[model samples]
Every structure is written in structure tokens, then in C-alpha cells.
Target: MSTVTLQEKKSYRIMGISLPLFGLITVGVLTATYMEVLPKGMIGAFALMMVLGLILNEVGNHLPIVKDYLGGGSIVIIFGSAALVTYNVLPESAVEIMSNFMRGEGFLDFYIAALITGSILGMNRELLIKASVRYLPAILGGVAVALGLVGLVGAIIGYGAKEAILYIGVPIMGGGMGAGAVPLAQIFGSSLGVDSGEMLSVMVPAVALGNAVAIVVAGLLDRLGKTKPNLTGNGELMELENKKAEAKEEVEEKEEKTAINFPMMGRGLLLAVSFFTLGSIIGKFLPQVHSYAWMIISVAVVKALNILPREYETGAFQWFQFVMTNLTGVLLIGIGVAFTNLQQVIDAFTIQYVLLVAVTIIGCVIGSGIIGKFVGFYPIESSITAGLCMANMGGTGDVAVLSASDRMKLMPFAQISSRIGGAFMLILASTLLRFFI
Candidate 1:
């Protein structure tokens, strides 16, 4: 190893000391604020949560074994924040404010809007078309296997085959909160003559737990790819043969379009929000479909039809990069504090509970990986996008799992799993529940 420079060593020492000092000071401030000695409000709550998320993320990113196997700080920011709230380290008021910012203030929606708009628009038209068609079967395979395996595991664990598939499997395999569990609860509740609230109470935990497990498994898969490089595409979701003759001119043409300027970024932002709004308006009219789904369709049509100019696509990609790099920590913190419930997860601590969820995730990976190979995708890439993405917590989970696997460029595929795959879940649930009930 190269010897460290004195300046670098000094910087490291400073960081080592400053981080702990900052922690003690932050604790003092939080305690005073909790007691009403320091002023408390949204500002403090957001700032503190951001700080915690970033710090936790940094620590998780660098922790030796964790960075390799558990997706580092992405998982940490979430479960760690939940732990703070559960242990009363985070005061209820602060947690509530953070929750409101995420849900009531719509931060999660904001992040998803930007990500979906940018990713879909930025894709190569031909590649997008080729990928989307092949991707669906991979997603279906994941869903089928995940539900089947969870049911089998549940039976062995005495969780019952029907209950396992109906409650644990569907919920865990469902998209995520608003799009996944909420609608599923309504469908199942109506069929079973039980209240929606009761169904949600049963479903939410499975979704949360499944999301957590998916993220961790993604990290493990990343490590596996590193140790055995042949199994992965290394960010290319499709198969490639570097030694063969290829379409060099097409790549050059795509590269030429990637010019950047401030005005272009602004245009990109406007286009993104406008597309998101169009989806929202459509969603208002079509209550059955999620806005993101509509947005994906609208953008995909525009891309496939070559309606948008090349410059605008580049702009969207640049804008997405900026937002993902800067605001990801903030969004993750919000998910942990607002969306995760420590008590609920804790209450779900049973062998059957954990085993069933594990089986669901494994089923997703296996089903998607196998199907993806036949459809001309790399097995690992297919599993991540088609399987784990379906098993995750919708949009936010998409970001977390993709980040963990170091494949943020696969956002479009990830969104498909969340939006379209989630839609498929609703349809399947509606049909299956009738038989089960």
C-alpha cells in the first residue's frame, strides 16, 4: 500500500474526532429541544434527520463487512432510524414531523416523480422497447415463484398454506404502501367480509419486512458478483460479447446527444414535473391505476415514438443524476422515520414470519433469474430488476435496492417492477382472493 500523506492523515484524524463531538452535541440539542428548552419544529426535525441519515449512510458505506454484504448505509439509514424512534431516542414529535414531511408534505412522491420521469425519458428508445417486452415475463416468473415458495415454507412452518400465500406472500410481494398493500387490503377485506384496517394491519408488516430483506439480499448479491464476476452484467442488464463485432456508430450517435447547459437542465426539470402532473391528472380520472404507472406509459410512448428531441433526453438524465446524488440521503431518512414502524416489525419476530418472507424473496430472485436468461438478460440483472424490485417497497425501495447493488442506471427497469409489477399484484390478488375466501 502507498503511504498516506501527512495532510491526508491530518484530515482523517480531524474527521475521527469531529464525528464523535458532533454526535454528543447533537444529542444535547435533541434532549434540550425535547424538553422545550430549545425551540422545536419542522426545521430542526428535517435537519436532524438529514444529518442522521447521511452519517449513518457514511458509516454503513465504509463498515468493512457491512459495506460488502448488507448494502452499507442504505439499509442502515432505514432500520437505524426506526431503531431510534423505537427506543425513544427520537422523540415522538420529531418523528411525527418527519413522517408528515414524507407523507403529508409528499417528499416520497416528489422523489419518485423526478426519478421515474428522468429514467424513462433518458433511455435509448430501441433498448427500452426491447427490454420492456422481455422484462414482463421475468417479473411474472418472480411473482409466481415467490408466492409459491412462501406458501410452501409457511405450510412447513405451520403458518398454513392458504394464510401464508394470502397474507404473507401477497403482501410481501405487493408493490409497496399506497400502490401495493392499501389496495390489496381493500380487495381482500371486501372478499373476506373483514375490515380493510384489519387486512392492512396484517399486510404492512410483511411488506416492510420483505423490503428490508430484499435490500439486504441485494447487498449480498452484489458481493457475490464481485467475488464471481461471470455471473453478473456489472450494470449492463443484457448480455454482451465484447469480442464480437458491434454497432459502433449507434453508440457514437447516442454519445453525441449528451450535451449539457443550464437552460437544458431547467427544461429537463420542467418536462419532468409536467409529465408527472399529466400522470397525476390522469390518475385522478382513473382511480384504479397509480399515477406512476400512467406516467411510465406516457413517457414510454413518447420515447418509443421519438416525440421528444435528443437534447431533452440528455437533460433529463443529467437532472436525475443530480437529484439522486444529492437528495437520496434525505429521502431514505424519510422512509425510515415515516414509513418504518419499529414496534410492528418487532411484533412480527417469529420463525415462521421471518422464514416466509425469506422464501418469498428467494423465490423472486430464482424465478426472475431463470426467466431472464431465456429472455436475453443477464441472470443477476434480471433478478434485481424483475424480482427484487417487485419484492421491495415500491419506488423508495427501488432506489435503495438499486443503490445497494450499485446499479442506479437500471432505474427504468426498477420502476417497472414497482409500478407495473405492483399493478399485476393487484389483479392477481383480486382473482385469487375470490377462490381462497
Candidate 2:
């Protein structure tokens, strides 16, 4: 008899399903979708997104150069899905379902609500207050430098300084599409007596291209941090000199001791939704501020005042971890399929246009990094949150950029840049159009 019995093969999985089973499920889903017999609403939408997202994510993370420097799976998920849609690789019916689920049904909002509520609630109260006080100035520094640099380059390249600032610089830094560019198009149209659609035509490409650049640069920055460890705080945004390292260690120890509680995650979900609801209600009253900004403020206030119990805080953190670990790939798929327009990005890739966008991003990085250092934050973290976050496409862009940088903990600051910084751009654009137009 043979001395050794046959060894069992190890199973490989994607999204928790073993490879063989997952392949069968993927085939069935695609067949159903192709035949237009896929179930409607969340059931159909979630299945398709999950399948596409996991496949793309796995491939992206494994590619050699792409994994090392090009934002790994995060970049692949967004642009890969965008290319699929652009090339008609995905069925139109399937695309429509994904779009409706992501935008029409507000899946992005639900994900962001949990992230913001949980992230803020779980933060150290002292660090939160200290960082929040200085964050706005860092954001302003990025905006100022990005716009100025783009305008200077535009004039040098004969692209027209004022037009470059208005079209390229402002849109790139104005947050994302809905909160930033759409409103900006309306403002520009009314001021210049042109159609808002025309204004959008020019701005949309800038947002898309800027978002792509932000993701790439974020990945590069992460690599830079690894090579030069002093440049980054890992995930910690600021250096709290007065705060003892032992205290942080103690907190981490306590966190490790707390086992994952299913009921606690349920409470976390409820809390996240409730805070988001409160933000919406407040937005109704304060129409000028974005609901996300209000939500950040509300969460910070609750945290600062110690209004919530410790258990609830831990619960929120647990929920955030769960969503971040599992749903990020799915969300990236939604963003690519729904928000990105590959054709627009390609059409806008003139030498001058590329240079202008690049200059804007570089300026943002330099300016925010310098200012952020003065205010006690690590340069890499500041540039990612205050600089690249501002230049990327609003909420979706924030997630992508942070994901690329491996700094999901900075969600609170990224939201501030997208919502508050974007709101500021609208005001600036409104004021500037008066003179330029």
C-alpha cells in the first residue's frame, strides 16, 4: 500500500464563495442578465455588481505593476468597469439596473452614511477637536494653489488664464459631479448666458480625468510613504505630541479584546442611518451647506460632547469595518458603471489639457502638504485628504482616492473636503464669473 494518502486540495474563494461555485453563480447571473430575466431591484442589482466587482478586484490586485503603483484593485475596478460600459462589453439592461441601484436608489448615500457616522464616532475625542480646527485652512490652501497654478499654466500655454481656471481648475477641485460640477454648470450658464448643458460638456471630462489622476497619484504617494517612512503617519492624520503613545496602545488593546458582536453591528447600522437622517433634516433648514458636511458636523458634535455611550461607539466602528472590508469593491463597480465616462476622458486628453490638470493636482499636493505640516498633520495624509480628495469626484471620488492611499480612516476629513471645500468652490466660481465673463 502507498505510505501517503492523497492530500486534499485547498479551496480558493471570491466574496466568500469557493472558486468552482462562484464560477457557476457568475455564469448563471450573466445568462439571466443577458436574457433579461434577472430579478428586479436589489436582488438582481446586488448580484451583478458583486460578481463583476469581485472578479475585477481580484484581477486588478494581482497584476504586477498595477498592483504596486497604479492603485491596485481600486483603479482597475473603476476604469475596468468604465471600459466595459464604454466598449459595450456589459449589456445595456444590466448597466441600467446598476445605475438605478447606485444612483436612483441611493446605495452610495447608504454606504457613506455608515462610514462617516462610524468613523467620527470611533475617533479619539481630543484628536478630533484638534484636527477639525485646522483642517479647513489646509483645504483652502490646496484650492488656492491648484487654481493659481492652473491659471498660470493656461496663460503660458495660450489656453486662456480665466477659462482654464473656470473650466479646468475649478471643476477639478470643485468636489465631484453632483455637488461640484452640476451646480457649477448652472452658475456658469446663468452668468455667461450659455446653456448649462454646454457648460457641463466642458466640465465633466475634467472631473473624470481629475478623478483618475487623483487615484494614481494617491497610489504613488502610498509607495513614497513606504520608502520614506517619516513622510507618513500610516493612517494617523496628525501627530499629537501631548498625547501619550501608551494611551493609544491601551485603546488598541481594548479594541482587540472586544469580540465581534452581531447585535452590536445592528445597533451600529441603526445609528448610522439615524445620523444620516438627522443631517438630511438639518440640510432642509440650511440649504446652502451640503448634507454630508452637516452630517460630519453633527457626528463630530455628538462625539465631542460624549453624547453617545462607549458601546455604541464601538458598534459604529465595527459596522464601518464590515462595510469597508466587504462593500468597497461593489461600490467601486457602481462608480465606474454609473459615474465614469471613458469617452469624455479620452476626448479631453490634449497635451495642454493634460498639463493643466497635472499642474492643478501638483499644486494641491504641494500647498496642502506644506500647510498641513504647519498644523501638526503628516504631509502624506493631508495631501491625500485635503488635496487629492478635493480634486476627485465628490463622495465616490473620496472613497477611491482614500482607498488608493490605504487611508480609509481619513473619511471624515475627505468628506469635509468634498462637501465643504466643494461648496466653497461654487461660491468662488459665482463670484469670479462676475469679473471674467
Candidate 3:
């Protein structure tokens, strides 16, 4: 234990010393973005550097334009890489195993549990962010409802409850195709009696196809929307104007402030540890223990409770960001490495397998798109969100899809609504299907 602690400290120290190197790279890249002439490989390099830049920021340093742009960019990188890997668009072995373990009746236990836990934690975080923020109450309340449903469904269905689980995870993870093949594997496992090894390979292509389906559908929607502008409503115009005003205010505030000072690292670390422990305790006691869910939820809840003051110290925010960034990085990197071991799954794709994937993709696009339209989002935005659900087939994808579409100037609230509905159905349907199929 002592050795490990020492090593960890040493690693952090090394990271601290190495911060400037990353900052330098980030600055160089930012200059390019400003000039609108960033090279190709620089794009990937920039994405990778953003996370490092945030770490540097936490430790107290500045690297010109890099600090501002790259830090936030890290969030994007974390999101995008996870999306690519989760959907099997990227050939990473760790994703294969995790996705497999994530699939089916057995898989639902952990994920659904996590969904519940994350919401609870997120609410606590929301409270910390601002109790008066009008949106927090409703959102947190919805999360509670979703959590309860997930736990109830998981307890009753067991491993067969994967479809239900996917529905839940899909919205949470990244929406549609990014939601990935865990649900299909669940279905295949229970209904077809397919082995885990065989199912892993079956799911990869399905995930990719789902994502592709989403993109194509979204693109088509974009084209269609061009012909009928603002069919989605003009609520976003107001939102955009407000955001711009907020940005200007923030810029003025930054000028008045000295060096950015985040809160101490201790608080976030303590909160993270608390949540991890709490999750473990809850997961163990739950009828069908899903520890990961507990861990995730606990983290969010603990952080929320600990950090939700109206006037948080700068150091506190910095530490909290660090903790979250590190947590996300470790989990994702672990998933990436883990997927490397599942080569067998991809080696034996059959005709039936191909068809199954095709159908799933189609279903995701059509289902998600219809839901988006009903919610009054621009067609492109709705389709992307739908595609995210249908393709990678998860919430993270939903966020990414929505965010991506927003970049393309599409209305994204539809994405949010789609997720709310899709996640509920995805989990419930998947779990219930187990018994009949």
C-alpha cells in the first residue's frame, strides 16, 4: 500500500513537471484554430493535449490561448473518443469485452444500478451548482424516477433485462449507435443462446452500423430541414442570444480576476472516495448488485453535496474538475485497453450476424428520428439524436450527437427529450423482452 501511494505521488509529481510541455503544444494548436489552418494530424494531437492542458490549469499555470480553448476541448475529446470506441467505430480491444460484459440480462444489474446512482449523485451536484437554478429540480426529479425504474426492472429481469438496460445506458452513455451492441448481445444471449465470444463479434459491426445509420439519417434530415427552415421553432434563437450575453459577461469577469484559482484538490478527492465507497455499499446490499452504477452515482451525488455552494472558491472548482477528468480518463482508457483482448469476437461474422446488425441500425434511426420530430426539434438535430440512440445506442452518444448537431446549427432540445423517452423504453423493453423471447 505504501509503495503504491508513493508511486501515485511520484506519478502526479511527474505529471506536474510535464504540464508545461503539454501547455506549449496546446498553445501552438490554438494558434492554428484561430488561424483556421490546423493541420490534419494536429487535430488528433490537439484533442489528446486538451485533457493535459486542463490538468495544467488545475496545478496553476497559463499557456496563452491554450488554457482557454484546450481545457474545454478535453471534455470534447473524452466524449468523442468514448463515443468512437463505445460504438466500435474505433478498433479497440478493451471496448469489446466491456461491451460484452455490459450486454444481456446479467449486464443490466450493474448498469441500471449505476444509472440510478449517477442520477442521485448528479442531483446532489446540481444542488451544489445552484439550488435556485430552475432546471435542476425537474431534471433531478426525472433522474430519480429513471433510477427507480432501472432498479426495479433489473431486479425482476436479471440477465434477460439487457434491452431495458441498453435503453437506459444508451441515453446516458451517448444516445443511439454510440449506445453500442450490449443490448443486442443481451437479446442474442437470451433468445438465440449465442455464446459471449460469438456475440462480441456480432455486436461490433452492429454498433458501427447503428452509428452510420444515425449519421446518414441525420444528414438527410439536415438536407430536408434546409428546404423548410425553422420547422423546429425559434426557441433556440433566444437561447443563443442569452448564451452570447453570458459569454461576454464571463469575459469581463475574467479580466477583473487575477490568475484562476481553483479549490483545493482535497475536497474533490474526498468526495470521490466517499461516493466510491457509498456505491460499493449500496451495490452490495441491492438484490442484484451492480457496483459500477453505485460507484458512478455515488461520485456524482457526493460531489454535488460537497461542492454545491453559491460562491465556490476557484481552487475547489479546479480540484473538482481534476477529479472528474481523471476519473473519466481512467475509466475510458481502461475500457480502451480492455477491448484489445476480444479479437475472437470480430473474427467470425456470419450472414445472419450482418443482417441482425443492419436491422438494429435501421430501427435506431427510424425510432430515434420519429421521437425527435415529436419533441419539436429541428429534423437534423432530432435525427442525429435519434441516430445516436439507434447507432452507438446510448446516452453519451445522445449528448455527443446533440452537441455535434448543435455545432451544425440544429436545435438540440429534441435530443434531450428523445433521450428521456428513449432511455426509458430502451431499458424496459430490453428487460421485458427477455422473458418472452
| Number of the predicted model whose lDDT against the real structure is largest | 2
How much lDDT does candidate 3 score?
Answer: 0.38
Candidates, ranked, lDDT = 2, 1, 3
Q: How well is each residue in 1-437 modelled by candidate 2, as lDDT tens digits?
A: 63631223247777667777788899999999899888877889888888888999899879986664444576678779889998999888899999888868978778777777776676666655544578878888888899989999999999989988999999999877655666676568666887654576577767767887888899999999999999899988777662353254321212333689999999999999998899779968974555555676788788889999988988988998798778877777876787666676567679999889888998899889989888877899989999999998766678878988999988877866875577667667766776785
Measured on C-alpha atoms, candidate 1 has an lDDT of 0.74
Off by over 4 Å in 1: 1-45, 91-93, 151-260, 376-437
Instruction: Give each model's whole-structure lDDT.
Output: 0.74, 0.78, 0.38
Candidate 1 lDDT over residue span 1-437, tens digit each: 88864434443322244545556656776676577444344466556666676678878878885554444566677668778876888667677777777767766666666666676676666655555577788998898998888888888878898998998889877887655775676567666887654576567677777888898888888898898887789987767863133343222213235656778888778888888799879868974554555776787788889998888877876787667766777776776676566666567678788888889999999999999888777888889989999988777788889988998988877876776677667668866865776
**Model 2 alpha-carbon miss at residue 432, Å:** 10
How do all models score by TM-score? 0.67, 0.70, 0.44
**True-structure lDDT of candidate 2:** 0.78
Error of 1 at 252 (Å): 12
Clashes of 2: 2
Better of 2 and 3 by lDDT: 2
TM-score ranking, high to low = 2, 1, 3
- Clash number for each model: 0, 2, 73
